[model samples]
Target: MLQVFRKFFHSSVGVFAALGLIVMLAMAFAAGDVSNMMSSGSITGGDRVAKVGGNTIGTAQLTKQMQQAVEITRQQQPGVTMKSFLAEGGLDLVLDQMIDGEAQMAFGRKVGIVAGKRLIDSELAKIPAFQGAGGKFDQNAYLSVLAQRQMNDADVRDSFARDLVSRQLLAPAQFGAALPQSAVMQYAALLKEHRAGSAAMLPSSAFAPKGLPTQAEVSAWYNSHKAAYTVPERRVIRYARFDESVIKQSSVPSDAEVAARFKANAAQYGASETRKVSQVIVISESMAKDIAAAVAKGESLEAAAKAKGLSVASLGSVSKADLTIKSSAAVAEAAYAAKAGATAGPVKGALGWALVRVDAIDAKPARTLEQVKGEITAALTEEKRKQALAALTEKVNDDFGKGGALSDTAKELGLTMAETPLLVAKTPAGMGLPAELASILPAAFGMDHEGQPQISELVAGKSFVIFDVTKIIPAAPAPLDQISAQVMADIQLEKGSVAARAAAMKLLAAGKKGGDLAAEVAKLGVALPPVQQMNLGREEIMSRGGQIPPAVALFFGMAPGTTKLIPIAGNKGFMAVQLKAITPGAVAANDPLIGQVKGELNNLAAREQGESLRRAIRTEVKVERNESTIKTVTSTLAGGN
Candidate 1:
């Protein structure tokens, strides 16, 4: 049993249980002949959608699972409508997963692989989400989490039992998977291979003539790409903010009240003495006494331990209240009484006898009421101000609910009202508004243009705002005259790029026919670019003096001496690349890369084997479809009348 747990922990399933649970749930709900099952209405024992060996899944069970899936979907996406969920194939997926889970469970039962109550309870206790404040399993927390997902204790236990049995049955595939050494070496070599190449850059600016585009050309370009120039619809918002700063200074607590408050929480103002100590725990009192004596003779506790084949562990700094270990109270009392550099104790502890040495004392002085009066007053004032702000925020929300105008509400509440400039969906940085308001822009844009005013929290509840969309500006293309200068520049650059490409092609043709590249470029009144060698790999491309152009990195897939023209940035130029050589990187048989590849390959094989086993079990199981029940459930969840 111990070995089984050990093997399960070392397997892929154990390491990825949390992620795998979600995936398994999805798959369990997404399998089978869902279309046919949804078409039948009066389903009896004959309505079994599937029978794994002797176990049958009837329409009633399928209906229950579908309802649970709907609840789960609602919990996952709070505001998702039924239509949207079904449109995304959520129902179909759920049915499939349910069929798959039932098939697996039936197979497990057939093979006598059942999870006992003890195992189920043990696994439940290990889930961190079910633990509470004291770090122990809390029944209330466990029930609450399940309730949130519309799941009960039995449902959870059953799911976990199925998962356990499935894993146990599939253990052989997961534990005994490995990849061939040759496959590992081949993958490693491919990943490490590098290529060398040279490139010549042709800049469009060198070929562009000084001129503006003809009227016909400009109109044609604008007509063909009007969508690119059109702006998105934008909104102008007006809002009124309410915060603690609006609270009156006269509302602050008086000095007497501050002193009274401090008195009520006196323990918070008190301090406890902390001592830094180190101790060596040994099996016997005589051993502890010998170590204490050695320390008294000017030998360090660490040196004493090393001589005795032991180690000293630091207790760090701790107060008396924090000393919870056995005999810790006695150790703390002894160490606190002694001055710094003092040694004490061969004290008996739960583990063994302990030898303690005091390193330092930190005596925190108690703070007087007068010393903390300002802090208490400030805190009380802030609390009162927050209370006032909360009330004001509620009042603002009430006013908005009553259909009060934003400007009128600001006037009535005495809040500062302001209007934002026309803003797009994506708010740019450095906008006048604070980050909190900027974060709300996306949500605001998603709302109906003429929707009711919204009250949003800001600065993590420090402030609040009641905002409404004041106006919406429809998107339109800018006038041609307004952007004529930029348009003319673009036209010139386009013409320049065409000329540059033509010149590059001419040089390429000449070079291919044994013409000197430098001489050919010189004839066209252009300087020939110096050829620089580069080694390109998956990581990056490098030359002797600097990094090569990223466009030349594509040469890695080309054969040696192959040539191609790759585009440069901004539609402004092209880089003519010539592959010079290919070099395969050397990878040792025992390299870490080879091991990583092997691990991934083995994981893939394990997954395939598990799938095959599941399929085999499914094939042996008999299945029947009740199409009417499925269609009824699907129609109801999809909001059909």
Candidate 2:
């Protein structure tokens, strides 16, 4: 059901939809500007990859955008390798996007639609990653992020300018596009239609070859399909864990340190009193006295205030100092001076004359040094422990920077060294490893096995880990001898799949020629499972969690009395879909579904118009591609480990 709905929306809506230049730029800012792309060094001798009008996209720019694309993809698929990414036309897509963006901007300039520096600056300030703690653009953060991305100010500003210009040029084309009601009604009918059919699964296993293939056959198949047997790169990580507990000496605070801390924060340990008050302020002092007199005559403060068309404000529980700042020192003093259940405030406040009712009082007595000794000691110890842990981490990092080993540090610190089995980037099930290790698993996979040992804090200053890659198992085809059994099994399945498809096709032909499906299945003479009946509506198909079975979808797509063959997922078999009947659907005029379909089709129509505008703009600008440089970059990225 959604397939037909999605079909109308798949068309490229210019560079905005294809590249989503602005969205990608925001993502790059948030995702820490894609790391330097050409990690294996430049392959084009710094030549330009493309030229749009007078603007040239150099190798650095193309590769950087390509890397950004890959980084964005890896957010959803973490194990995506650069080689696989480039092979999947990631380089072409990014380069095309760059060319399109440049074309749009150049076309924009010709029409006097220029993105000014202020406009670019405004866009940059909107990115959260470029904002400071005050939620505004910060020069320091902007400069720091630029340095981290290995990009300069001019290049970053140019990127923003191009994106802003592209948006300005293409946005108007799709701004108010909508499909007519007649078209929407026709599309809405598909959702209410229903179909009935018969489906038969011709299992490959049911038609398997009699015997396994010989070793020679397995060798040829293995050689031809080596990628099927390729192993993902794996690593063994050796690590040592340490925490504040290891710094027993420095983490322990002395008595003098505790006493000094206590002395410095003496005000924190002083006696304090707070009062809960119901207060009301009047513009005139005499009015406050009247309210106070009424309260003193057995009327509640809240009732007296309500009679005067005023509301009593419950100041919760607040200290004298807090109340003084909130109201006035006189009001606070008067409230505290009165006993509980008494009305004593008819005093001047910053707002006006204040009348307060003392409802409750909470008093805390001052504690002697001995009473708080343990508490002070614990606090001092915690502070000292954090300081000591930070120092230890710094020392370890320094030692590692100087070529010291994790083993040496582990031995010196008396930490227990541990090692993981050869593992992929994803944590295997049941490993129960530290969550911190899971967080850094991708980084570990990216690290060079021969590089220096690295330290990571597992729990900030409290706990940390020092780890190094112990062994590297590079990805390659598994040895033929080791996987011979698997190869033979695959060969048999391939043979059986061929037979199943032929049988399914023959059945499909017979059904289409108006033969009975039941009779056709019986003619196979192999005692296959009976034909499965299907009576499903569009809503029923959609209710399968959006994963409609191939046969069911085929049945729905077919006309009444028509049949088609659909291959089962996972090479399991082929499905013979015989559409016996189709029930035509009638939609009423006032149905809500019609309105829903119209809204969706309107968005799709808008995108179509936008894409048309983009195509015209691209045609208007001259774009040249350096195929040789692109190919070279592709080869290098695709061949890298």
My TM-score estimates for the predictions, one after another, are 0.60, 0.66
Q: After superposition, how far is residue 426 of candidate 2 from its true place, in Å?
A: 2.4
Clashing pairs in 2: none
Q: In terms of lDDT, which candidate is strongest?
A: 2
TM value for model 2: 0.66
RMSD each, Å: 8.6, 9.2
Give the per-residue lDDT of model 1 (tens digit) for 1-641.
22222332344443233222322233332132222233323334455544444445555656555554554455447777667767888766666566666666667777788889999788767666666766678999777766655555765666667666666776665677777787778777877777876667788877787766788888877777667677788888777777766655455898888988998999888986877888888898888888888988999989987788899877888776665453467776776777888777887766788777788888888999889988998999878777777777788778878977777777766888788888888768447455658866876677677536878887765877778887787788767777666666777888889989998898678656655544556677765466455666744543333555465556766677656677778988777766666777679867887877788888998888877876676775544445665676667666775
Candidate 1 off by > 4 Å = 1-24, 27-99, 110-112, 129-150, 188-192, 199-211, 238-384, 409-419, 432-436, 439-456, 460-471, 489-532, 537-553, 560-580, 584-604, 611-641
> How big is the RMSD of model 2?
9.2
